[model samples]
Each structure stands twice: as C-alpha cells, then as structure tokens.
Target: MGNVIKMDVYRMLRSRSTYYILIGLSFFLVFLINNSHESLLDSQKGLPVPKAIVGIGFDGNLLSDQMSLLQFFKVFARSQSFILILAIFSVLFINHEEASGFTKNIAGQVQKRGWLLFSKFICQGLFIVLAFLVGLVTVLAAGEMSYDEIVLGNIGQLLKEVGLQFIFHLAFAGILLLIITLIRQAIVSLLVSVLLCFGAFAFLYHAIDRWIQQGLGIPDFTMNNYTITGIISQVSIDSAKGQLIRAVIVALIYGMLTVGLSVTIKNRRDL
Candidate 1:
C-alpha cells in the first residue's frame, strides 16, 4: 500500500494538469478578491452595489460589509466551481492507470487488488488537503492586500467548516471514482460528474420527494436532507449543531458506501 501510494503521489506531481488546476484556482481567488474590493469601494462612494457583487452568505444574508478572510473561504467552499474542477481532475487521474494498461500489471502482483484502488483514494485525499490549504493561503494574502481590515473570524469555526467541507468534497470524489471504475470511460465519467456538480439531477430527486409526500403522506420527509449535494448546498457557518452532525453523518455514509462498492467491484472483476 505504501509503495502504491508513493507511486500515485509521484504520478500526480509529475502531471502538468495538476499544476494547471491549482494555478487556475489561484486566478479565481484573485478575481473574487478584486470584485469584492470593487464592491466595497462602490458602496463607500454611495453608488449602487450590485447584489451579485455583494454575494450571499451561508445564512442567505446579503453581505453588506467587506468580506472577511473566513467569509471568502466560505464562498470558495460553497462554490460549484471548486467541485467541478475536482470532478474533472478525478476523471483524468483515475482513468490514467486504466487507459495506459498500468492497472493490469499492478493488479496481478497484488494479493488484494482492492488496496490499489484504496491507495488512489488516499492520494485523492492528500490532493484535496493541498488544494484547501492553497486556497486558504491565497485568500488570506489576497484579502489582506485588498481590504483595509481583514477579519479572521473565530478560529474554531474556521477549522470546523474546513473539516466538514473536506469530508463533503472527499465523499463527492468517491462517487466520481465509483463512476470511473464502473464506466471506465473518461468522457462519460466527466459528463456525469459535471452534471452532479451542477445539480442536474435535482429534478429527479424533487419528483421522488413529491411522490413520497403524496403517496406515503409524509409531509416533512425530504431526500435532499440526506443527500450530500443537498446538505452541502445548505450548510453555513451559522448552521445549528444538529445540522452539522447530520451533514457529517451523511457524508460518512456516502463516502463509505461508494468506496466499499468500488473496492468490491475491483476485487471481483479483472482489471
């Protein structure tokens, strides 16, 4: 497993796409910071600041003041752009081994082929952590340079949000990994992942919820409440403790189920 992980790390580092994605993220942060600064300036001048420019908080409130570093982090966390980028990256990275027939060689040597897939997941987690830290540092430096006052917010809350977001992202990545494992086609997996990130299947979930409410007469029941995408859409810094707990539980369940299914398929099927 250690050797497999090391090889994955080496491959990931050598890939030019990895650096390109991170560089793109840095540019995105710069754009957001510049827009935020402009919005603040316009507000000070008594000009009408666009609602879109003001942005919405996790609590659904319009941000009237200059955004703090923590607030910027929250914006990045909630943005579909980050998830979309990860989806594309996962498709490319996971498909590389299969496309090159590298997996066949490794699978024959390993007693437990499932560990090979698990090792890739470990590397996925590491990449996510690196991306999160890179985003944090970018926001911190850029926000400080752009704003007159940079509020750091509560340290505990920041850490909590980061941890929860990481789990949510990892679970989402697991779903993409499963899709890639099953389909083994990069283009199809990429399309499905993009749709998932954009909530393209939301109508299906909503229709099911409606049917359950009408047939079973369960008025308070909602499938979104238990879904990763739904939970992430609603999670905010001000979310109640109970809500956070539920989000964590849902993330864990989805992550474990997807990874387990992928490993089972890997072990039973010839790679």
Candidate 2:
C-alpha cells in the first residue's frame, strides 16, 4: 500500500502535466476569487462591510439575517470556491500517464492489478487535498483582506462548518475523478463532470416529484416562494451531516468500482 501510494505521488510529480494542472487550477481559482468582486478589495472606500461584500454577490445576500462566516463560507465556496478546479483535477488525474502510455507499461509490469488501481485512487485523493489546501489558504488570505475582521465566537464551530463543506465538495470532486478513471479520456470526462455539477445545482424536483421535503437529503436555503425544493436549495444545513455521510459512501463506492472495472478491462485487453 505504501509503495502504491508512493509510486502514485512520484509519478504525478514527475509528470509535467500534473504540475501544469495544479498550477492552472491555482491560477483559475485565484481568478475566480479576484473576479468574483464587483471591484477590487483595494478599491473599496468606506462602505459597510456587508453591503460591500453583498454587492459583489460572491457570498450571499448580506441584507438577510442568515449571514455569518458559516453561511458566507458555504456561499463563497459555491460561487468562488475551487471545487470545480478540484473536480477537473480529479478527472484529469490519470490522463497524463495514459496519454504517454505509461499506464499501459505499468499494467504489463504488474501482476497485482488491485495495487495499481488503489494507488491511482489514493493518488487522486492526495492531489485533491494538495490542490484544495492551496485554494483554502488563498481563500483564507482573500477572506482576511476582504473582511474587516474574522471574529471566531466559537473556533470549533467555524472549523466544523468549513470542514464539512470541504469534505462534501471534495467527495463530489472525487466522484468525477473516478468517473474519469473509468472513461480514460480527459476532455470527455472533464466536460461531463462540469456539466453534471452545474446541472445538478440548476436542476430541481419541481417539475418531477411533487412530494419533495426540506430534509429528504440536501438542505435548501432559497428565499423563493417555490412550493417545494431540495433541502440543498433551502440554504439550511440540517441535512449536511447526512449529505456528507451519503456523499462519502457513494463516492467511495464509485471510486472503488470504477477502478476495479478499469483494471479488469485493462487486464483482459490484448495490449
């Protein structure tokens, strides 16, 4: 297991594409964080902090009562967060070697296919964490500069909320990476992952199931008077715990199954 993980890390770092992907993601995230504002932080004169932030729409409606670091993190995470970049990262995780035919050579050298698959998935997760931490630090820095202060009434609470959002979002990203491992192509996988992510948020059950409940799965936080919507749309995180649990479970299943299937197929192939 250690060898597998080490090999994955080594291979990824040795590859130019991997470094390029991380660098590109960093730049893309910084762009999102920077452009998410109506004007640069340096341009703000003396307007109310909430109003100044709300005007940018990077976080949420500052005029509302549900404003806080937790809510702000959730909103900012979706709008300007690098979850998309992370997801794209995962989808492209294995492509560099595959494109260069390194994966095929390794498959020929290895008798244990499971180790190869495990290493790839583990590597995917490692890269995800690496890339995410970079974005997290960037966001933290940007948050410091953007906000007048970051008072932590309960430091534990802030970490808990931020941590859960990070987990949920990361798991979502991993799912796409696993999907890519199955597809073994970069562009197709990336587009599919992005489209699914964007479409999931825009999609609602209004036109389908009329019996949707607030806590069925995700929390909805929208102010619209819609008769029904997923809990995710409501903005309350009553279901986040459950969502996190389920998302992790499903992502793991997808990751393992996809890796397993890919190995089986590759092993059976003539080349």
TM-score of each: 0.87, 0.64
Which digits, one per residue and each the tens of the lDDT, describe model 1 over residues 226-260? 87767766776578988888888888988999999
Cα lDDT tens digits for candidate 2, 1-271: 5766788888777877667877776565555544433343323543443322322234334212222455444544545234555556666666766788767777756776556656766766666567656655555555454444433335566577556554445445445545665677788887777655444434453433333334454344332222111112233343456654554455455445556666666556554
- Per-model lDDT: 0.77, 0.53
Relative to the true structure, candidate 1 reaches a TM of 0.87
Which whole-number lDDT from 0 to 100 does residue 55 have in model 2? Answer: 22
In the order shown, the candidates' Cα RMSDs to the true structure are 3.3, 6.9
Error of 2 at 165 (Å): 3.9
Lowest summed lDDT window (length 10), candidate 2: 223-232
